[model samples]
Each structure stands twice: as structure tokens, then as C-alpha cells.
Target: MFTENATLMLYVENVQAEYDFWKTAGFEILSKETIMDYDTFDMKPHADSTLTFKVYDKAFIKQISPEVADFQPSVLFETEEITELHERISGLTDNISPITSTPFVSFNFASPSGIYFAVKEK
Candidate 1:
């Protein structure tokens, strides 16, 4: 048997809004596709890797028992495009704000679902 990583998918409340947020967070558009059950769009900077966020109907959360506040944030994106992303996202979200220098210059924000994310130049 063989296995390969495909994508990191996040279930979001508003697909277009979350998509725009990540765009502001520095990820480039990868591709967009739809399945019988849902609509999804992926964004990434490289060919070998992908990050996808999907928006589905209420049934999508039908069995989500745990409180969303208890759900930990899932991924981090590192990029040299941080500045442009920061500017783009900051205007759209009240939660987006820049952080001081660390290993990389970065910013943090929340998705439409309130999932937190940080992006830094790598």
C-alpha cells in the first residue's frame, strides 16, 4: 500500500469569507472543486502541498458534538507574502492584527468560524 498527503481541510461557516481571509493571510489560490456533498476551494503556495477550506450545509455540522470553542486551531502557513496578506485581511476582520518580530514577521486572525490562524514569512 502507498499513501500520500492530499490536503488540509477545514470546515468553515462562510466559504467565500474564509477564502478571502486566507488570501489576506498570504496563501495563493490553488484550485476550486465541488463534490456531490459540498463545495470546496483550496489555496496554497506550492505544488506539493495544499490547504483547503470547505463550506457545506447545516448537515455538515449535524453531529459535531463538541463545542467549537473547544476545537483547537488546525494549521499555520509560512510565507514571504505576509505583508500583502496582512493588509488584505486586516481590513476585512476586526480580529486580524500584526505581531512583533519573532522567528518570522507574522500576523494572526480568525476565520469566519472563529478558527484562529497565524501567518509568518518563512
Candidate 2:
């Protein structure tokens, strides 16, 4: 069975814009390259992280798999410093939700393409 996740793919409308958002939000970029003549970015939560976040153009995916073009994954990020990270990210995007504790102290934020991701204390 598959266990380790080397990468998670994020297909967005604008690759460069989404890539910039993650970069500005403080994600470490591993590399930027062209796959199938399309721009793709590899990023991770930190420099030593094993999990990679792959950013690709939605149009490219649409061409390859039309049915999954609009599929956006629900990403939840765990951090030891939730409040601190939230505060730092707040300056980057205006579409961030205020922190709430339904069970754990957490909040949600949107990307440039209106895809929301969650962040919670570990």
C-alpha cells in the first residue's frame, strides 16, 4: 500500500499567482520547472519537509483530465504556533477567517482562486 506522500498537487487557475501566494505566505520553494511545457512549482512547509506541494495550472490538468479540472483538495496544516502563523499570514491575504476554536484553535484562509485551506494547532 502507498504510505508516504512525497507531494500533493494543487491545480489552480493561475499558477504564478498561487505560487506567489504560498511564497509570500512563507512556504519554502523547492524548485520551479516546466512539465509538459507547463509551469509547475514544488514547495513544502519547510526546508526539510518530506511532503511537497506541487502547484500546476488548472488548464493543463483540464487538458489531461477534463473531469478533475475543478477538483480542489481540503488541505489542513498543523502548526505549533497557530496564532503566530495566522497573524503573519493575515498580512498577506484579506480573505482570511478569524481564529475560532470549535475543538482546536484554528482558522481558514483562501487562495487567489478562492480555494480555502485550514490551519490548526498541532
Task: Please tell me which predicted candidate would have the highest lDDT against the true structure.
Answer: 2
lDDT of 2 by residue, 1-122 (tens): 97676788888988889888899888998899998989999999988787898888988998999898888899899999988999888987899999999988999999998899999988
Q: Which pairs of residues clash in candidate 1, taking residues 3 or more apart in a chain or in different chains?
A: 24-85
In model 1, which regions exceed 4 Å deviation? 1-4, 20-38, 45-58, 63-72
Question: At residue 8, what lDDT does model 1 achieve?
Answer: 51
Error of 1 at 19 (Å): 3.8
Q: Please, what are the lDDT tens digits per residue for candidate 1 over residues 48-118?
A: 56344444323344445434423444567777767776777777788877765876687788777687878
RMSD of 1: 3.9
Best by TM-score: 2
Q: What C-alpha lDDT do the candidate models reach, one value each?
A: 0.63, 0.89
TM-score of 2: 0.91
Per-model TM-score, in order, reads: 0.63, 0.91
TM-score of 1: 0.63
Question: Candidate 1: minimum summed lDDT over ten consecutive residues — where?
Answer: 50-59
